[model samples]
Target: MATLRQTITNALLMTAVVSMATPVTAQDCATPGQWLTPGNQHAEAQPPMGWDRLARQRVVLLGEQHDQAAHHRWQLSTITALHSRQADMAIGLEMLPRKVQPALDQWVAGELDESQLLDRTQWYRYWGRDAERYLPILRFARDHRLPLIALNVTPEQRRELSDPASHQWTLDQRHGVPVPLAASARYRQRLMESFEQHSSEQLSSHISEAFIRAQLVWDSSMAAALANASHQHSLVVAILGLGHVQYADGVPHQLTRYGISDVTGLMPMAAADACLAPTGVADALFIAEPDAPSADTPRLGINVERTPQPLGPDRLVITAISPDSPAQYAGLEEGDQVVAIAGHEVRDTAQVRALMARSLPGSLIPVEVLRAGERRQQLVTLPSPSP
Candidate 1:
């Protein structure tokens, strides 16, 4: 089975757009699967407290991959459901920096157009440029007059934290706010393990420390904002990245330390594979209708790291060949300058990728390369990408 982490990433980072036009009803979503520890048993005939229990909590965290359209739909629906039950709630967003809180206020007050709201917030610079993607949630907030709070430190603050001099408590602390809490030992270790996945650079103490520092401050700040907003009879719902909601390792941990005791975490699990043996991932793993999975891109099955050729026109050279790959079988080797395929010039890796997307398995690709100062050509069969 795919890990919960991988499943969420696939939904979040897939290349194809799974567009959503309207909010998804709870009826439209997959019934959430419970992730219980092995040997744990419930005494009640009925299952545990569901969304209503969540509504009664002081703080409710709806974790999302942010880029997934369906995740946004789930968020909107959940917020609407909570509102219908007369839950006094305000939503904090991970997208905008605290500097743009006024812009959010103006928009919620109906003083700004969608285009103007994005501009005032400097959307692409701070969050992202896709305003239409979040219109559903924004519209809901405006319609209901719910507070839309900005939930991040400024970009300048982020840059300062990255500086070596900013490590001191006084230099980094936000005025009047508590200093950001350090991540627990387990959280730091997990963060480093994740950092190692996408980073090609050799892991070093410095890299890990810097990344952990930034992440702690991020989670801590968001946690502080949510805690402050959580007043008597008020429930604060935070929309955040999936990584920040794992177990009690993230925002929940920080909030707990700050004395916000009652917090619940909910993760969305798409409908097709909703029910499974408990992974013990969160309070609940609900599902949304999956977007159409994107068509697989054809591959040459090569692990060649691209290197830039700088003397003249920018070009790419193969740093290495993947084992058991078409390129290796066809005699492509390290340090070979990739020149073309099937008479089309290979200006860069993107061109090759574009070509491969059109190729089928068993299709012969005539690859040209410069190896050991001499030009050579080989006909290599394309391969299907791994499932």
Candidate 2:
């Protein structure tokens, strides 16, 4: 029998968008077997089938692209279907932190409104400008009184996991030590490969090592939490970014290491067609689009106006520069139009930020300016960005 992962991959490969010109009838989506073939080996496989069996799985890890609304919709639908069977289910989310668990729990228990549950800054990062796609999931969890566990690793831990040399050093030197493990010859070769893939560099070696180590710690913690849950709970679903849940070395593998062999990983197929394949820990996957994409473009701090022209795309504008920053030290004033950055056209704020973000401290970046209808170039030594 094909694994649930394989089945999800097949379903995603065969997905077609519903159209208003040719409306999709109920028969088209009733179930995979009714409209699509089961294990059909031909070019055109079937849609998702076996919902009844899938609903019975003990643990379901619903992998998602943070920005996709359609994936969220499909996730809600799948969860609702499983709920109808009266399966005891809990949702683990990556957006919130473990420290905020009490607040999250209180919100889920109908003690808080949406605003209290998700503040503006937090909401913007997770949902972006599309509040519609995210609000429903929060509502559903609240209505069901399901527990919402925060599964993301802390920022300090994330920094630690991104480093590599610390993995070779003393355990005390590590910021957050991974659960100690005796050498398992079975995993020795894989461990070597992991080490090789995540080598540290002069500037970034520590950070990279820390990041990997943190992942190990996080996976172990998550698995332990899941395994310790009441057996009466039929399913535990974890919602996380694709990066953390994609590879065999990711959380699912860590879960297996902790003795939870019976686990299923699912990802939204629409985000990346390749994720549907059962290459690593992902057991089952589905792909779906968001209801709509967000239209708000990100804004940058700088604006420019060209000399002798009121407004034009090339008329660069400098909205704001960091206080006591290199640009400020170089006599760059707000509303002083940027003629160029190192002789390149100042098209928009994005280019400016990108150039600045990558600049090393004390590196001289040439800035051409149009101030009071005068053109001048200044060499500014950039300061290091704060950690």
Best by lDDT: 1
For model 2, where is the 10-residue window of minimal lDDT? 12-21
Q: lDDT of each prediction vs. the true structure?
A: 0.66, 0.52
Query: Can you write out model 2's per-residue Cα lDDT over 89-180, one digit (the tens) per residue?
Result: 88776555455677777888888876556542243332223445556877888898877776554544544543555457564454324453
Q: Give the alpha carbon lDDT tens digit for every residue of 1-387 in model 1.
A: 124323322322221122111233323222333332211332222124555777778888887766567778878887887787655789899777788889999998999987577657766546543455578899888888888888787756754554555555572265223456767786676676666654555767876676666677677778877887886347888888767776667889889767887888776655433343134445755555455565676566554444655566445578767788888888888777888777766554645665665567667889898888799998897775565
Q: Number of clashes in every candidate structure?
A: 2, 35
User: Model 2 Cα RMSD, Å?
Assistant: 14.7
lDDT of 1 at 274: 33
lDDT of 2 at 112: 83
Q: How close is candidate 2 to the true structure, as a TM-score?
A: 0.54
